[model samples]
Target: MSPLFPDLALPVPPDRPALRFGDRSLTYADLAAAAGALAPRLRDAGRVAVWATPTLETAVGVVAALLAGVPAVPLNPKSGDSELGHIVRDSAPTLILTAPGTELPAALGDLARLDVEDVDAAPGRGAPYAVEDVPDTAPALVVYTSGTTGPPKGAVIPRRAVATTLDALADAWQWTGDDVLVHALPLFHVHGLILGILGPMRRGGSVRHLGRFATEGVARELNAGATMLFGVPTMYHRIAEALPTDPDLAKALAGARLLVSGSAALPVHDHERIAAATGRRVIERYGMTETLMNTSVRADGEPRAGTVGVPLPGVELRLVEDDGTPLTAYDGESVGEIQVRGPNLFTEYLNRPDATAAAFTADGWFRTGDMAVRDPDGYVRIVGRKATDLIKSGGYKIGAGEIENALLEHPAVKEAAVTGAPDPDLGERVVAWIVPADPGARPTPDELAAHVAARLAPHKRPRTVHYLGSLPRNDMGKIMKRALKTDD
Candidate 1:
């Protein structure tokens, strides 16, 4: 399959920057040539491991590997030596792609290494790659999940899945050549790599890539006139908080073609507040590492507050009860596990056939491990993570998201995380981890309990509320619910 970069690279405006990282900018011709030169090196090396932080280097590595027909694996740069060694031993990558001075194990000392600076060196005006005939089902990339529930498993995302996702997004979101995207999400995550990078780039739009999430830096990009913005919910919250005094920041953000929030659920109030402050409502979407992204709310329509709008053009979703019976979307607020059937879904876990088999239904749908409800209009409201987040008290099951959403409404609460705590009589009780809005004026546990009591059902209310200095998060800013659960 031909890479999406070749045709996009051609006829691009010569003077304009096609990729931006900090003060450095690469024109379309520069990036294409850079990718063209690195392709052969990657081919000679075989499977490549990319650990570059979210920067132009990561983007360059991805495009070059695809062009060279090399299956690329992207890792968190902060992964320790032991973890990195595990990946190295398991995948046995032909080359490691990362920053120049990053430390490597003795096993990889003699192995080939390609740094972003090396790739940025004079473009090797070598033979343009003879497009390798890779099958649509062949693995294109391997990305490990958050590894919260268990050991990290490599998810094999095929070329067809990537292409299908990009094609669907372009059609659903109406991505065009005229759009300019200011992207702040990490490149290693599916949301960042596929939706933030490939989705826009494949459609002929330019990307202003940030090395990391910097609210002020992103604000500058918006001020510089980016047409689109993509980030996680936490990033948006911080951005909103940073602009409390500068009203212009909100105005600049409102002018974007679209603003996307994903990777974690965003509160309805946060969505409304962001929209009211900035001119555009943030389009909340739903997806995971297994599937790139299959649902989204449109920029033009009413983005129903809590719902992640309908499934994309080529995707189909079904709700199934615990007993494997299909549930009607209109069964009076009945919620079930979301099983997805889509071209965008990943092939399987790299070497975990049993786990892969377990993740899918007896039919073809991939079990998302997430519970959601669909309104009559087909909008999906993700209740919570099925295994780690549901609170079981007495004989009833409660969604932690409901209590957290209610807790967030309090004036003294900045954020909230709810987990099930083991109880004597009930299987588990609701436990809330709260981040205060005011350091000194934070509410007491009794006060917070009263606050949630007012909004949630008697059984759904949190039995204990613990004030936390800060929530533990991954590189992508998603609260580590698995870690928080074990903390207590």
Candidate 2:
């Protein structure tokens, strides 16, 4: 088994920066030495709760966890006290690590606390404790759900599974030691843990954290020099909107070897607009918390506008109807639920055996809970979530993405979300919530209906549309259709 941390750190020049947070830069040697120094402190704790949002602390905590054999649970620092208390109770962490001002949840206030700013707090009692190295199959990290559907469920990820995901990303994206990854996503989600950090670190590449997002800061980083960039659709959209006409920003973004978008479905128009703004297509991939990313758009070939490309080398994908029978072929046009079986699939929901059992097929394929269809060319386009997002009306199915895509085509529309709202006559009615570009340039309901009718079938067009300042989105940029439905 390969040691999670390379013994000698990355082979980059000692003075060369491997991590950057605004003006701060840490060389490869510094990170390695810091990780080594922090290792014993973590080892003493046995279990650590890192309540820091995506930052250098996350990267350091993760690296320290691997080195010390302590299991790390990363929580959203901004989570409310009640939610934080629930997480603390569920995970039962031995020690809490946080920045000076982090509010402690009532339940965890009495636990031993380690101040993050004082990295040297752990004394140098240098005798290394013998630890049974965690096998690849042993649990490494526990990530909780976003609590969109209900209370967050902790999902335990095995070390092997994490490594498998990293390996798959490396193989598919051709990441190497020479690549530098600049990440602007939250570490609480799988996107940051596996895609943003592990994928690059496993390949011996240097990974940099943005701490907090500012388009100008990102532009400055790109201008300063970064080979790769990864972010969600929201981050990209913000950056695209803020610096629309800056040629220098455009050039810096276009110069990256690769730019990736995932964690949520990127609307087709948003995807295209970003590509036009920056000369490279933002490669969209498909993944969920249960399965770390398993598919991606090709680096060299034509990236289709509405589809995420084929499965990675070691991943197996199967589409099934509601009855759970696999579809015959990838015709790309037939929509069905996407089922995945891969080396990277998570072990189970922490302490929830029944839910875990129900999540998998009898034969072991994970029930992704996401519906998608494949084209004749084998490209995959995700329909909305099965239970909440997809709308059905008069025996016809409608996808949020499809209507959102159409609405985005209108110059006045900034963002849109479509959902099946309740109705007495139709089984369900298509409802749209939109953000308009011009305050007074809102489309009338008839105009909006006619706008979608021109491009879509009668059943597919939204019957009701509402103009809003913004659509409610989660941290990862996925529209909360359920919340919208609840609001009505």
Candidate 3:
């Protein structure tokens, strides 16, 4: 493939903005001068850890590492000591790059540090980078993703995977250099770093990062010529809540070219509310860390609420039975495990060959462990993870995502999550965890059961209901159902 970023190497308009974090911003020339100067410092350094704090330095550090043909591991700033320690030891980087004033956790205190501010961004300070030095098979990043056992596994992502995923998304989203994207997502994970930041740079476009998410900040940027907005379901939910009181937010949202949501299934209720107020439907996409991006609702196609559109270009996707046979009939009801094979797939789990080997089939398709069903028109609607989402109660298999979406439609329900728990008669019964819109007049369990039963079938209704002040969520705003199930 061509260079990861063609424009970064050659000279561009010095005044053209490339990255902005709050009050600090970097133009195209400034980015190249800084990343290019620091690229040589990372040339001999083995895998390096970037103290990812959603700042300009973190972005420049990762880019310099990529330019130097070395694997960069992004460390989450909010990680606890135990979780942080595990990643540092597992990745074993020789260097850690941080912003000038940021103090790293004790887990990374031992690594040799290179503060980006200390580096001189003088033009022609270092030898220019050769794209051929990094081949398609060369490992570009070792991104850590959560797992059940031990700690989060570092997925070794190759240059080809990054190149192809971005190219495919460009075709899918009609993304171009003219598009200016805005988001406030953290810099640690794929959703933020890869898609949110790097995707813009690769397209030779500019990105404006909200130091943190707020409806007012989103409106300010979107109203100021930003065409696209990327966010998770929680951010979108907040937008839906503020739409009535904030007409400026609604006007800004309606004026944008695209508003995309991911990392979880956005409840259909939020989707409807946003569209009703803005007259613009927020699109949903499906992907995982190991697989950079699998599918997205096409920019020109119908913006269906729940479905994450079709498989992205160059990605081969299929729903498989437990016996490993691909499901043929797409009747919009048959549920199966999702298996995908593509150049976009990560190389392996860092230092775990056994887990890597088990993740794939004999034929080479990677088992996603995500349960989903395909509509007759080929839209894929993910129900939930196979481990936590599928509920086989009373001899029928049901998807928690669908039931949760239904519950959110209730006037009293503010937030909802559905899970399967052990039952006496039914092998596993559906349980609902709800955050009511009104605490004083919360919907009764029987009322909720009846409401769900009337909308869906009787078997799909929750067997029990529990009210909560709010649901526990991860940094990406995904509901932690595992925490809910174990009461952790």
> All models: lDDT?
0.78, 0.75, 0.90
Off by over 4 Å in 2: 7-13, 100-107, 116-132, 486-488
* Predicted structure with the largest TM-score when compared to the true one: 3
Q: Give me the runs in candidate 1 sitting further than 4 Å from their true place.
A: 6-11, 99-110, 116-129, 485-488
lDDT of 2 by residue, 290-344 (tens): 7877788877656777677888767899889779989987775566888999888
Q: Write the per-residue lDDT of candidate 1 for residues 416-437, one digit (tens) a residue.
A: 9998989998889889898998
Model 2 collision count: 5
Clashes of each: 1, 5, 0
Report the C-alpha lDDT of model 3 over 95-133, residue by residue, as the tens digit: 999999787777776789998873334354233455446
**Residue 382 in model 3: shift from native, Å?**
0.5
Query: Model 3 reaches what TM-score against the true structure?
Result: 0.97
lDDT of 2: 0.75
Ten-residue stretch with the least lDDT total in model 1: 120-129
Highest lDDT: give the candidate number: 3
